[model samples]
Target: MDAEIEVRDVARRYQKGGVQALEGVSLRLAPGTFTAVIGPSGCGKSTLLKLIAGLEAPDAGEVRLAGQPPEAFRAGGGLGIAFQDAALLPWRSVEANVAFPLQVLGRSRRAHAARIRELIALVGLEGREGALPGQLSGGMRQRVAIARALVSDPQVLLLDEPFAALDQILRRTMTIELQRIWAERRITTLLVTHGIEEAVFLADQVVIMQGGPGRIAAIVPVPFARPRGPELFADPAFHALCESLMAQLAPIADSR
Candidate 1:
């Protein structure tokens, strides 16, 4: 079952001298849709993702997954998250790392063996399952992380800068690969990214944020058809939209 995410008038503040991170930030992601949040540093992008992931509580307002609170839905194994760092255990093989979520939930590994294998192949790490994280390259390690995240068959997937560390070429490749993987199973996905082009490419809607107590600036719907190919990157309309989004961000940049 796919899940929807809702953030309603959310606010957060750090206790150390009341550093406000987010204020009146709200977003709703319909079931099986992809939404990407983009903004400058200190814009509370990761803070919002963490809130949806149940890692922190808002000082005010609420976040819900499938109409239930984040913690309640997460307890049922409905959420999956991947971060910028692959964060794989150096000692664990690709296959073992991908299976780690099941281990954490106390599910029998044998019962999920086929699911593990499918996710490995899905992420294009098929024959390298036995390879340890130390043996894989940066992109490959991130692939392992992605496979691990999806192994739980989550209804909602959250990603924070999942491809930010790669070189330009590798990052583009991984972005395309991510789109392909996402097409296969349209989980409700929320990605927080700094790359404007990346946000425009992978998201159904591109959400722009402003800092100094972060809040939504705009939500631009992506009109391109999918499976979005490499050629879309070259399309004039694509560049036009990118330029328009850049224009919106310019003032925000100037204000910072």
Candidate 2:
């Protein structure tokens, strides 16, 4: 089933620090579509993602997934999240790590054995299923993390700069891999990224944000066709849109 996300006039404040991370933030992610949120540092990009993931509650307003509260849907294994850190168990093999969620949910590992293996292959980690995370490269580990996130067949996937740690070459490669993986399922996805090109390449809409009580600055639609390739990076139209987004974000960054 497809999943839709809605955040209505959401607001969040950190009482200890007396900081308002987000204010009057609202968005709707259509079912099976991809959306990327980009902004300068401390613009509450990650905060918005957490609110949508149900990892944190808003100080005011509401967040819903498929008409149910995020917490409610999340409890049913309908949500999956991957962060910059792979966070895989150093001791567990790739397949073992992927299967961990099912174990945590008290689902039968035996029943999910094939599914786990399939996800390993999907992330291009087929032969490495028995390899421990410690033995894998940074990008490989992140691929395992992606597989783990998909093991549950989640209806919604949230990515928090999953490629931020990789070098430029690896980051671009992973971006392509991610685009392919996302195409296979078309799960409703929200990605928080710092790279303007990455956001444009992967998202159907690019949401620019402003800091100091973060709020949406602009939402730009990406009309490019699907399965976007590396060549898109060199396309004049692509560069123009990215440059336009940069222009919009420049003032916001300066203000911060």
Candidate 3:
């Protein structure tokens, strides 16, 4: 089967030869798959996401999405991205914020109005559409950010530690919420996060990266059946998976 997204021998260096952000990394994301990348603070997880999103270029090797280059795919409305911060315009109302991408692509308001409403409901923010970003809670703002990401009907969603700012309970809630959204949309997704348990819970595959000149250290398949809920956290299988990931990441921490 063809991968929805493929990274072949990718490398990225930053600071004009000061630091290596990523070195010799490669991975493939299956269609409709949810993959999470986890590593230490400077492990290039976010850099990888930027490469796939075409926000940054690889210093070497290639990143392809459904057989096209990242820039081409991104320009063709094939990619969506949500960052750690909601990054919403404080001045824009919820509906307007969600509609921002569509407008940028020259889509008429009438053309995408129904789709915007559907996305609003998808993220469970129906009546909040008229509110400004500052009026919403952190989780709600992130939900709006998610709605905006999907507004363009992207084939793949790239997330960079999207729920990391929330309180633990809210973070867990958003995790389940994100899974539900992914299942409903069936969009291939790659998430960059530092939380090991979060990676195991949300990913079909968990990729652990080594620190500094970051590189893939391990790729572990998460065999847990989904639509995973809080109960999955209590399962022995889940804990075992977390333990295994922790073991792989331990060496990276020790080396620093």
Candidate 4:
């Protein structure tokens, strides 16, 4: 199968200088795979997402989507992104927010209404379609944002700490919801987050990054079976994986 996304020795630096956000990073994501990137703050996790989304170009190396340049894929709606914040329009009702992307793509209302309804239901916000972003809780808003991201039917989904703002209970709930959605949609997903457990819970593979000119330190495959539940968190195997990832992150933590 073709790689859904590929990064080859990618590197990036800001205009201010002396700060290399990423250095010689590379990865290949198989089609329909789910991967998570976890690292310390400022470790270029978000930068990687932006490069893949074509929101930022790398100073060196290449980012490709299905053998095409990042630019082409981005312009063709091959990628979808969700940020730390929901970034929803407060004025738009839930259904309108989910329909925003379809409208941008010039899909007729009649053509996309059914899709919009399906997405809202997929995100578990079926009856709340008429409400505004401000009327929903943080978790609900993030769900709306997720629905909008999927409305375009993207080949790849890029998420940057999307569940960071939710409280513990809600965050866990969102993780399970995300897993269910991914299983239903089968889209390749790349998530950048600082949470170890979140990474382990949602990813088929976890890529750990080292701080200060970020680079991949380790690639850990999640050995657990799918359909994971809260009970998995209590398993010794789960804690062991967390400990191993924590060990890799320790140096970055100490340097800060």
Residue 116 error for model 4, in Å?
Answer: 0.6
Off by over 4 Å in 4: 1-3
TM-score against native, each model: 0.98, 0.99, 0.97, 0.96
Q: Which digits, one per residue and each the tens of the lDDT, describe model 4 over residues 159-224?
A: 999999999999999998999998888799999988899999999999988768888988999999
Whole-model Cα lDDT of every candidate shown, in order: 0.93, 0.93, 0.90, 0.89
Summarize candidate 3's per-residue lDDT along 1-256 as a digit string, tens digits. 2238999999998877688999999999998899999988888889899999989999899999999999999887778899999999999999999999987888887888999999999999999989999899999999999999999889999999999999999999999899889888888999999888788888999998986788999899999887888899899989998998898888898896
Candidate 1 has a TM-score of: 0.98
> Where in model 3 is the C-alpha error above 4 Å?
1-3
- Which stretch of 10 consecutive residues in model 4 shows the poorest summed lDDT? 101-110
Runs in model 1 lying further than 4 Å from the true structure: none
Which 10-residue window of candidate 3 scores lowest in summed lDDT? 1-10
Candidate that beats the other on TM-score, 2 or 3, i.e. the better one: 2
| TM-score of structure candidate 2 | 0.99
Residue 27 C-alpha lDDT in model 3: 93
Give me the runs in candidate 2 sitting further than 4 Å from their true place. none
lDDT winner among the candidates? 2
Tens digit of per-residue lDDT, candidate 2, span 125-185: 8899889988999999999999888888899999999999999999999998999999999
- CA-only RMSD, every prediction: 0.8, 0.7, 1.5, 1.4
Instruction: Give lDDT: candidate 1, residue 160.
Output: 97
lDDT of 1 by residue, 132-240 (tens): 9889999999999998899888999999999999999999999999999999999999999988889889999999999898999999999999999988889999999
Give the 10-residue window scoring lowest on summed lDDT in candidate 2: 100-109
